[model samples]
Target chain A: MAKKDDSPDGLKLDRRNFFKTTGLAGLAESIAAPAEAAAQSTPAAVGPGDVPVRLNVNGRQIDLMIEPRVTLLDALRTRANLTGNKKGCDRGACGACTMIVDGRPVYSCSTLAIEVQGKQIRNVDGLATGDRLHPVQQAFCEKDALMCGFCTPGFIMASVALLEKNPNATPEQIKKGLDGNICRCGTFSRIFEAVSSVKGGQRG
Target chain B: MKAFAYINPANEKEAVAALSPQVEQSMPLGGGQDLLARMKDYVTQPERLVNVKTALESTVTPVGGGLRIGAAMKMADVAEHPEILRMYPAISAAAIEVGTPQIRNQATVGGNLNQRPRCWYYRNEEFVCFKKGGDRCFSPQGENQFHAILGAGPSFIVHPSSLAVPMLAYGATFRLAGPKGERLVPAANYFTLPRQSLRMENVLAPDELLTHVILPAPGNVKSGHYEVRYKASHDWPIAFATVLIAMNGSVVKEAKVVMGAVAPVPWRSAEAEQALVGKSITEATAAAAAEAAMKNARPLSQNGYKVDVAKTAVKRAILRAAGIQTA
Candidate 1:
């Protein structure tokens, strides 16, 4: 791992050296004047630093103080105590970190928590009610669509988004829609069946 | 990933002000897909990150006869947009071929265009390649089955943008916003070669933001993109080609053929385009054009098969653009 010298002094020095080398010191100075004034005017505002971030998730507003580098996946799982989303390949090659953001399924691992503030974030944990599962979730359970169950949450989110986007999605559409999520147990046939079965509002 | 200061600029000017034009100290964050991955791998250690997603324009608006796609627009939205799908089908095809649905929902057009080459040698910290400010290109002497086959020299890394080839074939232009001012660059001159700059892939300065991709209206041109990948789903293509031909009744009036994953940049074959001019697209004509596309390919020892694969992609793209069924 790289030793992060991200201190304010270190960052300031880096910027100064960069400006010196790039011959942008004049422009940088002009821009920094107002920024420094704004910083002085604020009341202990921490930005470009770890601070409180509010997220409207599912239906509730959750607050967490985390560094800007923290991804939405980490913030959801570790900070908010919502662990339904799994981190498969953190670099976005895998879809295990899929979550619904404002009706669209995105790789939570790749999304920064600071970027999605005030957006309606949804995860697999929010799919089930007191005694009933979401229609898509119920479909998966009846069809035995998952074996390992690690990739199920992400698959469920993607399926929900797909169904919401195209209510009467064809088999080809289902295949293309769920192409992002990968089931390690090779349960694609059952998963497709489940998604297709629910497309017509079929119940278990 | 190392802890870094994140600045959320409310506008494009603030974002550009937060960025350093010459040095790589600060980087503009798009979807944070590519930047975060590199940060996690310790490949890039930027002291600060400027979040430009919120600052830049994220809407795809119609301008003149063409459509202007915001650099911050998600890949999924861009691929599914009605105008993009109807007018520029090749761009949508190429965008949909990128990684997967989740990735598409999160990735942005600017990020896709500026993504670093996924050369394993350059990605791995153990192997210091020329692209990574090292002495020599390890792919030239190391495992290079997935490396470039056409453009080889000091560096053999191929451009990894799926949308670039199609955009180039459509004669798209890019809009860049910087502290100085906003400027337009043609798609043809957007991507740079290894000889031009070893550290950067495109001509985007560090302080400049790739704001918009302006696609001129596709007038009388039928375009198609064909990609041949080892894995049909999420894997990058082994070779892909985007062909745009202006048809006059049954004959080709003008042609633009660009191949991806074959060179350092989007490899445009003037010879292939010349062969398609003033001729109908037949199996024989398509094959001849395809052959001309890769006639000067200098493949590495392990990537010799890519020459044929690229030619087949070119042939299929031409046939598809002409509405011919090769199967």
Candidate 2:
């Protein structure tokens, strides 16, 4: 048994204090080991490097260590665990990773994660209450706007953005506005119906 | 994806200073809707990524003579801008007709103007086309259905800038910031032919950043752009035309005809302009101008239809500009 250094007036020598002094140093060193290892592993400053980013995603402040290569889709799915944004084509062609960035609908798959640090990020996960679904989500379900449902979230988010921007959007505008998102299941007619119905329903 | 560094400068000077060294291996990111996708696809792997989105210096404002649209001004904002709608309606229309609403919302005007071509061979990683420093142009012998039928040489990829066509017609100029300072280049002369330089598109140097697009006062010219595409959605067109006409009582005084998706760069038809100038824009004249525009078209085996498409597009554009409905 190790002796405790009890120099205080009334404090008594205890085994707990003796063990804590020695073991606490080891625990602290172990806790700090990862950070030191990370710092040592990274290359020195040749140019500007990956910055620590703090973003407010879906009303939650998230701190993440992201490289310059990390896209918004990567940050959402990997770091924030918001997998509702599916990585479809991973290109700008398919809008599977659509999310409301600063009240505007954007393809998260093509957007850099660090670019959206301070902007408000709203994913499909933020579209529902405890037991109730959003009107667009409900409309998509009722209209059978999705077959595989892989592209459903993106379509739904795009619809919400469109309806919010132009509630009375004409059929031509609707077709033009939703031109970016692609559904491989060939449920575009139903998706259009769902969005158009929302426009009419909102006006009503 | 290879590991890369990131930078978010507060101002242009800091950003420029940060970008002093790695111009060749570094790239500035705007909305990242296009650049990041290209990076992820391994088409471009920059060692350092400069994030200039937060640099508030890039903003569109009504300036002295006309509108000074910032380089990072999103395409959606430009399309919906009231002043642009009033002055350059064709530019707004072209902006609206880009990829998609989401893309327009995120993609900057400068980025749109600076975007790479959408040719299938150019985009595909497997095929080593002429644009990628390969031996032969795949579109010549391979599937050249969407290839250019005019102003094409060593390469056949079409210019992808919709706003650029309208900008050229509107007499817009680009303001670029570089290692030296700010310099202006006419939008019409910004795009270079692949024959001139197969590896590059615009006249921008390695360290130069497109800062703003300066649209001259509308003056007395009536300009309009009309694109005829295969798909109404997010696809580039087969042929499009931008017509800027200066009329003197129903008779054309000066005409500028710029065609998009017709060549390696935006094809400006001086012959079409010459045919229209000092002449009334009648049905016969419109047809004549269209014929003059497509006279030099040398179509490939698959893209012979583009000649007719370009002619029809030119005719329709002239008619639309003249307020004469053909449909």
- Which runs in model 2 stand beyond 4 Å of their true positions? A1-51, A199-204, B20-24, B56-58
User: For candidate 1, lDDT tens digit of each residue in B49-91?
Assistant: 8878877888988888999999999998888888899999999
What are the DockQ scores of the candidates, in order? 0.33, 0.26
- The list of candidate 1 runs beyond 4 A from truth reads A4-49, A200-204
Worst 10 residues of 2 chain A by lDDT: A4-13
Whose TM-score is greatest here?
1
Q: What is candidate 1's CA lDDT for residue B101? A: 83
Best by DockQ: 1
Tens digit per residue, CA lDDT, model 1, A47-114: 55655666778898776655777789877775666789998988887788899999988889889887
TM-scores for every candidate against the unseen true structure: 0.90, 0.88
lDDT of each: 0.84, 0.77
Candidate 2, residue B205: how far the Cα is off, in Å: 0.8
